[model samples]
Target: MSILVIGATGTIGSLITQRLADAGAEVKALVRQAGKREFPAIVTEVVADLTDVPSMRVALSSVRTLFLLNAVTPDEVTQALITLNLAREAGIERIVYLSVIHADRFTNVPHFTGKHTVERMIQSLEMPATILRPAYFMQNDRMVQQTIQDYSMYPMPIGSAGVSMIDARDIADVAVAELLRRDKASSALEPLTLELVGPQPLTGASAANIWSAALGREITYGGDDVAAFEGQLASYGPTWLAYDMRLMMTGIQRFGMQSTEGTVEKLQTLIGHPLRTYEDFVREAVAEG
Candidate 1:
């Protein structure tokens, strides 16, 4: 069966497209426009914008499985609802959604709350679905790569609180497996929520140390100053976006972010290998530079 992948150019979705292609699955990569050089040769690119109902309908046509990964936007919930409605109409069988870890609880975080809204709707659909709530992305730090390279500091507002941050590549792996194959049979599979996390959690100090060791340089945690961090982000983008991130980071520190519980086992069960360690991510990042 063919699978439709949305948000195909994003950090997580891009990898999902590649993984699905690599596994010899028929993949339809949905894009707003067809740029010949953008997608891999294996993918069949379909032009569809999330808000464009006709386009989304055309993309969902004849696809059994759908990988739903929408970006954080002011109209995120609206776009997701539109797509979900169309997917239902198209009679798609399964949907694999990428969401944030504990998005249901952190009502204060704007984007997290948005994902939770879409997640509840997806659950209500009469279809088999998997909602993956991945912890803070390890690659999120790459947003501040400038500060990391020039100042030798991990400037995320994670504070000293330990976060069970996950690599986005691992998140993509889970999506690919659930879409093409599964750890269990169809009769056994049902609506499931997997809090995808890395093998271990890390405090700000611990993460800085990992990068320091991996990069062979002295790095430091920039400490917990939500206002200052938001100001820095504001310098680059919308102030409200930065404010929303400040709220999420504040919620993380206020409500502890480190809890692997049964997720590592769940991930290992899905991907047929051990969970990826942050150390491995660090080494890979360093080597890529």
Candidate 2:
């Protein structure tokens, strides 16, 4: 029973591949540019593009489980549908998708809507699937590294809203568990969705405090001007991405990004240990900087 991980060179996907490989499963990585990827020697690397169904078919051959994640792009929905169909046709039995929390509720945001569309497609499939909907990742902090460095501040227009952030490592751990477990009962094999989140929820101000502690400086929350922040993002990022971010931020501010339940319990049960805290992630990010 081999597991094939799509987008295996990416942050979360790479970690999932490593975890599955370490667990003694036959791991295969499907990467767009095969030669550029530096995976563990124990794992097999296959070159394939999700948009190219023939290539994806070749990549899916002989794989029993697939861990699906894709780069954020305009064509994500089409690519996902193509890959999901190909995987099903190739006899892949289980699919574990990494999706964003509140996908069903945030149809206005392109990224969340894209993920939600894929989740619906997966649910409609005959294959057993698990959709892991993790909340805003603490890893998102990396995006504001320069702001934190320059002004000792982190800015999010989401005001006092607290979000239940999860570390990408925990997401990968649970995904690998589902991929490597061969004895998954048929009842358990039915399509399911799990909300993955950190141990606790923290407000934007609290997150700034955490950054302040980690960086040894007073980092503060800056503004709640969503329009201004959106304009700022547009000045730096791609126009489509800026629009998407603006829409996403609007949803976060209005509905909040926090999960109502603790996804850490499921993560801990899968890994046989406690999930890493937001503080731990901050420390690691700072150390890496």
Candidate 3:
């Protein structure tokens, strides 16, 4: 049976969809509009909206596995709950949910709290699922890549305590593995949660240093000024989303986004390789620029 992939046009979701297709899995990409983006020829595109019940039911029908990833929006929780309910109604058993690391701890952050709420609902409903709580994504740096290149500064306000950032590629691989594991199982597998993190935590200064080395020029750490970051973000995006991101940064500054004990070894064992490093990501970004 096919696997339904929500948020398939997004950075991580696109990677997951392509990887699943490459692995010979039947993939149904749930896109809001058909032909909005291109996927492998083998992928079956399902035009559906998460908030639209009728469309979602068609998307969930006959899918053996579901990769549940939604963008951070005002009604993220609603969308997730609605989709999960539909999946359950459709008798779709296997699921892979992409939640953030420290989702429970960052209760003040709307997106984090929303994901935590979804996680709770998934567990309470006894859904056979894999909850992947990934740390800060290294790909997030792509947003500030131009700032680093043009201004010689790293501007994320990710603070001194540091964040264990994971690569989107690693996240996609792991999600694909978990989806297949449960989808092809002889029976319903037990629900599991995995903390996906990088090889090590990276402070703002350390990140700047990495970029400096990559660019062969001195780059400075733009200090933790989340207000400035929010102001800049608000210039281009919604004010509410900018403030929401500011709150998330504040939470990260207060309580570092580090991994739990043995999380690195556990993830390495699962993927059979060391997690990709921030330095490598920086170098590649620089090279591509």
Candidate 4:
């Protein structure tokens, strides 16, 4: 079976591509550029942009399954919708869409709202898809490594609600499983949505504590200040994205990126292991530095 992976150069998507290739599956990577990286011999790299219909059509051509991961952008919804529509027209049935946890509830966040729109589109279209709604990525903590090491502070305003941050590797593993399941099936399977989360929820303070334990030093939680966070982000990146992130943080503060009952068990059964913990992530990150 042939599978096409969108966002194949990204953090999670790269992992998914590697896993799929390791399983002896034929993989195609849809990238905007080529010669930037290398892939396994069985993998084919297709240079294509989401906005370019002809290129995307070529990328979707002859693929039996797709792992769609639209990066958070101003046009995420548009990109996803176009790709999905093209995939359907091309007779691609099996799909795994990377969506955000609580995409429906976080209406104020642009990316969340965009993903919700895509989810609705998939549902209404009656596509055979699996929506993986993951929580805040634990890898996001890498951005704060310097701050924690320099100032002994954890600077993310994840607030008191406590986010069940998941590891990107876990997300990739589950996605590969879904894609393979859909590809090997005799027919199109039912559409499913899974809430992928960590083993436990952790607040900003708890995250700091984990760092403290791992780094063997005191690390305090930089209190919930969405404004300061936004300002900091804007100083380094696009203002629009910074503002969009601010709204996301505001939503996280109000209602954390949490999981429902049996979420952990369900994910464990799918991944075939216990979920990775924030402590382990912090430990490995600190040790690597």
TM-score ranking from best candidate downward: 4, 3, 1, 2
Candidate 1 vs 4: which has more lDDT: 4
User: RMSD of each candidate?
Assistant: 2.0, 2.0, 0.8, 0.7
lDDT for each residue of candidate 3 in 1-289, tens digit (9 for 90 to 100): 8889998999999999999999899999999989999999999999999999999988888989999998999999999999999999999889999999999999999999999999999999999999999999999999999998899999999998879999999998889889989988988899999989998898899999999999999999999999999999999999989999999999989998988789888887887788899988888888898
Query: Which stretch of 10 consecutive residues in model 2 shows the poorest summed lDDT?
Result: 179-188
lDDT of each: 0.83, 0.81, 0.92, 0.93
Report the Cα lDDT for residue 28, model 4. Answer: 92
- Give candidate 4 regions above 4 Å deviation: none
Superior by TM-score: candidate 1 or candidate 2: 1
Deviation from native of the Cα of residue 264 in model 4, angstroms: 0.6
lDDT of 1 by residue, 69-103 (tens): 88888898898889888988987757888888889
Q: Which 10 consecutive positions of candidate 3 have the poorest summed lDDT?
A: 266-275
Count of clashes, each model: 0, 0, 0, 0
Off by over 4 Å in 1: 182-189
Model 3 residue 202 CA deviation (Å) reads 0.6
lDDT of 4 at 83: 97
User: TM-scores of the models, in the given order?
Assistant: 0.94, 0.93, 0.98, 0.99
On lDDT, the stronger of 1 and 2 is 1
